[model samples]
Target: MKMNRTLFLITLLSTFAMQGQDSLVSNIQEVTQVADTVKKVPQRYKVEGVAAVVGDYVVLDSDIDKGYLEFQQQGVSTEDITRCQLLGKLMEDKLYLHQAVQDSIVVGDAEINPEVDQLMQYLTAEIGSEEKLLAFYRKNTLPELRSELFEARKSLKLAGRMQAKVVENVEITPEEVREFFFAIPEDERPVFSAEVAVAQIVVEPEITKEAKQTAIDRLNEMRQDILENGVSFATKAGLYSEDGSKTRGGLIEGVKRNSQYVKEFKDQAFSLLEGEISEPFETQFGFHILKVDKIRGQEVDVRHILVYPEVPQSSIDAAREKIETVRKAIVDSTITFKNAAIQYSEEEDTRNNGGQLVNPVTYDTWFDLTKMDPELSAKVYNLKPGEVSKIFVERDRTGKASFKIYTVTDRKEEHPAEYVTDYERIKELALKEKQIRAIEDWQNKQIKETYVNVNEDYQECEFSSDWVKTSN
Candidate 1:
């Protein structure tokens, strides 16, 4: 099926926010017609009228029309969603973007262009070809479509950042959490899925000193080739880098100090001068040689080539034997599983916590079977509480191999939400409520100070924020 135009744009432009289309050319003429013989000008000047102006940004009628189309495209029943709701949302987006620009929140092209390239590539394949994609959007050239997409994406990022800023420091206290939980009536409480707490002990294959030196030597050779022979770093990275970013010449843009990268990787990246490449350094993943492309304030653009040392068959066999010994010790009651994990497991995040695998989404011990890792869920399906699974080989997306054994530490059947048992989840909900209130309060105040003008048609529509008034 041909993709919905607005839905495609929304998917390409934003993470969660849906934005309006900015098509400059349309054939439809809604106004009074002159002589039939007189050629009518295209709708860009007259028919595609402005719906509202928020601060410096204008929301067009086309934007509202596309917004409604986007909702329908997503299979949402828009029967209850009014034109007023759509207009209000677009205005709110504009307000946030305006404030973000005023506040000097930076989102550079280095961050946006990569997304544009990816989206264009995806749209071209889905819509059949580049020409068809452009024709579908009524654009004359690729740059024109890209420019509109960039602006839309930038606006989405700005609004998101501004909203995040409002609630960045908002927190809920235990008292607030209790109050929020109690405020809900008994019957309105949420039901939780059956949950199981999973734990694991992992042992990765040990690379020999010879293998380690080989990888380091290989990186050194590549660095020298690039510096002396003047080979392109990107070309080398595309050819030899094992990291996922290899496709883009190992480019990882918009890296902040607090980005989720390993400490060693961040330290190596930040220590380099612009356009300078580093010697091989080791992170948890592998050895890497990094190049700093550009630094904008606290953010840096970087590219790196990752190379993992060759693990000999002997090393793999030895790791398997070592893990087998640990499992045998637990099975024979010579060592407890938690003690074994603390002493022998090599996965640092779980080793210190008795190998307890916290769910990344919930930040808790519980894993819902439906959403749990398929391999893990399958292995633990028949395991009783406290029984350990047979040792299994695991390979990550990068093909880094490891051996692991799992244990189901606890289990609970599906149940309605309970206060004591689901305190963390409840706390999250309360904090979210507090954050939403904080954002709404900020928006309310900002709307009073900002320029807002709605068209006469929407003048009578009630809005969540005071949108009809202009600031004194």
Candidate 2:
């Protein structure tokens, strides 16, 4: 009941660190006076100055300040948030983490270490250097910062897993979705944004045979050195691999047989023995050499190096001209856009579907205008349904050039939610509401069973969960 209201407020407004010395003094004095009046302030708070403790985890007052600082940095308003609400969120997080530990939810080093590396990389780039990042965070060394980040990330991962487990089996039927939609007041129904169904034809640059051979030769040399010279595979991967996983020595852990790896990559990974490296193999992304580390039941841990051939400018020009030819045919009515896409588009995933782009976030055919990529929005904005855009060169994350032409298949103007037309969105909302209820029920039950203690200053704060008043 109160959970939704409290969470909504929390989302809109979270606490900010005390801005002025006067404000900080006021907070300390208020809590201090509360402590003096009660005459029952916990000794741990006096010593460690923790705000609250839930199960095995302690929420420090400084942690709440840091939370506020993060919210402030993200430009969230903290004007009216109370320390009590901040502490409540920390307590909820701790509760989830504590229960995750009790329930034996495991987060491995392989998962956490990469995240730490990525965070460090991002912060270093943002702060200008690793030394500046260390100084900004007041950390003396990289390992210290990494250790702290590791614990934080592990706790976050555990909390997320625990929350997900709470509603893992929640399901909503069509009847439930229908009922949920009509139950909303007519005027209170959400306004659906303008959305468009878009399709595109992509022509990828064909790699020259010489360039492809060069990439394969490089991998073969690296693999040979790794085997014959007793050189570290990780070292070669870190030095030469073009993939993002290079920072972690190209390590990918807990990969399953059903993982979303390309078929060639997965087949090579599954066929290798521990400590055995594979020969150079080709995938759509490019050539790779992988070494299996260990096998645990259905999961395998492996390290790989990826290398993509350099695309010649001639190939780029050829791709552009090819797409241009296709676009001309479509515009002149020689061939339909869908037929051209099916026959000529090189983007394999969408080619079979007539190059219709699915919204990755919603897994739907429609993309909301406001949230669509700016470049894509600009291209499709003026085009009415059935109009195709001029050929545009696009680059992949690796900066490989391609040419694409887009067609706007359908468009919807902003309107109040209609049950018939917005059934999928309605179903998503219904499922989310059900999951929230399930989480609330879980919290209510867990609070009674878990060890919880709040400072006297926060005992009076109204919490959505029964954090302050759990009884035997």
Candidate 3:
């Protein structure tokens, strides 16, 4: 399916405060338009017309018509959707943007620039290249598209900031959670699947001394080639750098001296004269050779080549054995699992949290079995509470191999959610609902107070909100 790139863009651009159902509804409105595929401008909408005016900003009919076509192209059924509803949404967005300006809410270039780059990357990849994308949009260059969308992007950020401000202090209590859970009809209550809470101790496979030296030697050779054999640093970086920016010839721009770069990297980079290449140096990731490209005050642009060392089979075996020992000690009760994790586990994310694995989806320790990693699920499927599994090797998302031991801390069979067993889940739901209500209330008041005007063309459309009645 050609994803509704426009809808995706709208959602990505706006950071609404109301989550769950309310957020979904707001998002739908934000992107709604006519029920037609966007192609060459239709004769009806070709004659430019005003849709609505909210405060200082005006919604153009062309905007809604374009969004409608883009929506249909994304495979969305706009059969029941209307232009009036779409215009209402556009006006709502403008209302938030107007208030944002009045309140001086600002989104800096640093924040928006990355989002723009990411969007460009996504569109370029989807359309098959920069050239294809430019042709599709009838533009000469990528920057032209960016410039055309810049205002829409700015308004999105502004509306997001305003929404965030409205619900910044909203919260829900335990009693409210209980009340909300009981209020749902019995058949409508959430049903939870079998879940497990597990803890783990992880040990990363280490790169051996020989492996480290080999990487350093390779980087040294590259540096020597650049400095003595007249090899271009950018060419060498493109050929050898392991970093993501290697595609851009290993070039890094707008780097500040005090940024989070490693001390060794920063010190060497700042000391180099423009166009000077550094001798190879080692950091946690690997060996690197850097060349200064430009300097402006405290910021310096540079290019680099990085080579990562491979962990050997012997290193993997050693790490596995080390974790096995820790698991044995825990099984023997020589030390508590939490204490052993704190003292010995190399995995930083879970070590301090007593090795407890939190579900990324729920942000809780309990995970639905179906949502767990298949290997992890198999290992713990039949384990009783407090039972520890044998040591196992697995690769993380980044493809880094590691050894780990799993302990089933708790388990619960599939059942309807109850007050005692699902208090946390209920509390989370209640809190989200409370926040949504707060946002709704705030939006209503803002709409009532804001100066809004709907054109006669859209005055007869049934809108969810009283936008037409409230418009001055």
Candidate 4:
């Protein structure tokens, strides 16, 4: 259940990289316009000055302003301390980018297109519609926005790759973890929260072959209506598509060939020509029919109508009955709970780990009681360690209802963190600190060796690293 911190860092880098020059300038302009309205000042401004030069890369004052504005928008106070920290992080990012280019790291469209599509989808949703988003950014279409953001995305992936290379071999031993735990001052020690470790045996409600055929038949009917009844595909999609984009006429625009869509969906989309409607196709989500509106090079604009098959009440009852039998076997000591989970559980991710539930944030088996699912927390509130709860139905993130049996393996009351009991948690903390130190050391060496020129304006600002040395 350990989280890959390196992957987390890479994702963070990609997000930062998505904030291209135009987007940053737009943000700054919005803020400036708001101020102008309040103070009755002119909205026009002179050119922004350079803040720093890292090797061959130049950091603009607008870049710093963009970072500052992002923090402010996030409700972070733009006081001196926070501002200095933000500036330091930005400088370090530039250093990574410059070094990545020097080291010949190549980031291709395959690595960037998916992230671009995701970001565009999020922004479009945030602004209520793609039309509104385009108007807000003064862009005529979504493709224009993607083009503007492409270089920044590429630079971000390069920086992420460089960071991965730096920390790929770092590891921590048990002794190191113990030493790191004891070294913390008593007052600085972390207070532990009440936590529980639970294991589950899950069985998904099965959709019968007949149910799948029913869904396929329904989709085929819709397809025939579109082709023969002179019904518009978008109109049919609006009336029947089960996806969130049904409100938008089931349209998805500016989708690249390499975007992270389902393989079936992408394959069908890329294979079709403009004004073509595909036959009903089955994907994990449901039965879907693709209508290609337009295709340009590797990108396409398309619409789809999805119809998910329904799981009958009998299927749910049968799954619940199956788990009840497994529970009985475990209770009668015929088989151990862990072995039962290994042999009979339908949940793939947790089955091999003895059906243990992991906290996504901490990536550990122990979950904070307050953060658990309301239904799950309520059920285990009174149960003692090693107690099993009765069979229950719960819907997963995707709304796929499943029957489950849960066993509370371990529980602990809130207390101060201890080396003996919290070794794994402490090890994770120590490893993170080590990784940060390693990155910092690398950044310091790069700053000393590379040519860094800071404007006098920023030279007085407090920096975490000595980027403006006398030699430089």
Candidate 5:
């Protein structure tokens, strides 16, 4: 399905955060738009209908409309932003960038390089190749385009920081939550599904100890050869690297900051300096040796050759047996499920946090069972609170299947949400309200503080979604 910008961003962010590792992956197209009023635009990149020019930045009409269409395709509702509203947004972005520069809010290479890679990939994919990219966009190479994207990275990071500031301090109380619930009428209150809380002892059966060692040995060999021969990593990567980016040689793609990563992969990739190669390393995906090619701003580019650790039948049996042992321990109450999770679970996020299940959509400890994976929902929803589940295997979208044993830590049946019954949920609503209010407060603060000047044409334009009012 075509995803909206917001949804796409959320998905991308979630993926990177969950894995917390490093390796180059695929990228999607990224673009921005705004409204401009200037007749003779000075910028080389123009897609008609001048949106707004914020100092050195210009928001084009195409940016907004393209995003609008994308949102529409995704069934997301966005009340059409008038040209002026778009301009306001453009101005806001520029303002954020301006503030970021003043504060020296530098982005990490980890964040910027992946984004550059994604954009570059998309551009090359669209226009044909590296040569075509230069010919069509009048850009010499990827680095020049990456420089342009660096500015975008700054704006995005600043906006994110600003947003965090708005919601970071806001807190919701149980009483405030009740008020929020009551504020919504019965018909308006969104109904929830029967939800389940599930815990898991995960087993990724991709790597056998022997195969894993082999991968390590190979990487070590490759690393030694690179040092001995001084073979360019990118040239080596293109010719013989086993990683997915073999065609591009080992050049790291541009990425957004705090974006998805393989937990081990990301950490190591971000830690390296320019022109350095990492010792052979291993992640859930497999073993790799990395060579850092370049660093721009806070983003880094690298190439790697991955050697997969062979999956063994005995290894699967061993993993399952371990899971069963944990299950039996839970059954006997020798350990609490959460504690067992913390002790034995390999899944990073939950294992570190006592195995509390979080809803992917709401990020809540609770979830709507209906929205869960069919196998998981069926297993988890049937269990009462504090029940452990049998080992079951599930496949990701990529057809990569893994085994996991789940424990239902919590369960809630269908019921009307009320002040007393859904106290926490109500509180969450109140907190969300506070967040919205905080945003408005912040926007008003910005308007009051920043040098904002609305165009004369937009002076009388009525905005339906006004966060702050100006004496225009």
Candidate 6:
């Protein structure tokens, strides 16, 4: 994504707006102490001076340091760009953030709370716990940190809206696409290789029998403690659950009723009443004893201790057999492909959707033979519509391999770009460019009126827009 500080500021503001005023101020004071509290940081990434200030907000020395460190981590070379490009991008954020407050954009509790939770989760993963994160940020607690970030979040969101407003309705015509295509240099014209869309019948690896037994034994031990020793399941989840949802006492958010989780995990979890414990059952993650915490209508919250079994050849052999059975069932007239998916597929994201791959570019439902990755598209190009290919190992964007079956439903090789093929996308792109121009124009005007003071240290630097007054 394009990096803009204006968006960052709005988001930061909105995030804090949800948090009460007094607490939010306290959080800012604490955040300012971030430099003071940094007893230890990554050795390679030393602090850099604060490059610029956007209005009242002081850009911190650590901000530039962290930015440099991340760029280095990502292997981005700064050899090509002059200091002008860097300053322009960095300082443009201040302009956007200032506009954000004037526009009165606010992000409320419903919006910020989830972000706070995600932030907490990330911090917990980074620093070991919420307490450590608080210490690192020089804050008293999570609530304090969240409150300070609320305003920033708002500032960021408003900046985005302003950007959208700048060119939201701009359109690119057929001529524009051709113009863009022709604008590419002959040497730089990228090879538009054939991409394919493939559907999947995924199967997870099976855990060892010994692993299952061990998990059962451990869960039984935990269950015994819960029953006899008065230990709470939530506490057990915090201490023992291996799933990412462990910290929230086994809470899983946004689960769909139509979706499928591991059958073993689901069957036992769904069967148990509230506050009841499930006997150990085996799933892809391994042997788990489930503690059913709450049921909200169609959803249930369960904390489970998953003890993964070391994979034995026999375990793979077993899992392969079970998945192949479903594959066979699909091949035969025994079950409709959709029915089999709904009944037997463990891949939750695509199970109810009938394992159909949706196009990210177009919201169109049909899988195209041409737009897929070279490796996948190569395999699926030969298959006819409605015919299912055999189980193939394909890596997702993350490079995780799982069992898959591709069914080609659509094949389009060439066409004059129509509204269906490219109009909306082209229009959206054009509109955004227009908006950016509009925003830049508006920003230029704003700078003329608004008091902008840059330290004389940057007088030689040619920013995107020149600052009005110089500060010592």
36-129 in candidate 3: lDDT tens per residue? Answer: 2444334355356888888899888888876666556434565655666566667767878888988999865433443454455556555677
lDDT of each: 0.76, 0.77, 0.73, 0.72, 0.61, 0.57
Model 6, position 184, has a per-residue lDDT of: 53
Tell me the spans in candidate 3 whose CA falls farther than 4 Å from its real position: 1-162, 173-195, 227-232, 256-278, 291-300, 320-344, 358-384, 388-393, 396-398, 412-424, 445-462, 466-472
Cα lDDT of model 6 by residue, 1-472, tens digit: 2334333333333333334232221222223233433332232322555556666555544554444433342234434434434455545656666666677655444344445544455556546777777876679965587676555556555665665554455566677666665565767644333334446567755544576677678888988999899998778877887654454565554333453465666777678898898877776555678777788787776677765545566655665777788878777868766666667666897788777666543445543444333465666778766677777665332223456665665554544334445544445444444445566677677777565655454567655565624333
- lDDT for 315 in candidate 3 is 85
Model 2 earns a TM-score of: 0.78
Task: Judging by lDDT, tell me the better candidate of 1 and 4.
Answer: 1
Give the lDDT ranking, best first: 2, 1, 3, 4, 5, 6
Q: CA lDDT of 19 in candidate 5?
A: 34
* Backbone-clash count (model 6): 33
Better of 2 and 5 by lDDT: 2
* Candidate 1 wrong stretches, greater than 4 Å: 1-53, 56-94, 106-161, 168-183, 251-277, 291-303, 321-325, 328-334, 359-383, 390-392, 419-428, 452-472
lDDT of 4 by residue, 107-126 (tens): 76655654565456556655
Better of 2 and 4 by TM-score: 2
Query: What's the ranking of the predictions by TM-score, best on top?
Result: 2, 1, 3, 5, 4, 6
* Model 6 spans with C-alpha error above 4 angstroms: 1-48, 68-77, 101-162, 165-194, 204-237, 245-319, 325-354, 360-362, 365-402, 407-425, 446-451, 468-472
- Model 5 C-alpha lDDT per residue in residues 1-472, reported as the tens digit of each score: 1122233334233333333223222222121111212222223334565545444455566655544443343333546434445445555556556555555666665555555555566556556677877765457766676676566554566666655554678887767776677788988786656777677777655465677787688778778878899867767667765543654576665533555677777777778887778988877566778876777676666677766655678777777778788878889999998888888887898888777767655677776775554555777777888777877876542234567777777778887776666766667557756775675566556555554444444556544323234522
| Per-prediction backbone clash count | 0, 0, 1, 0, 35, 33
Best candidate, TM-score-wise? 2
Instruction: Write down the worst ten-residue block by lDDT for model 4.
Output: 21-30
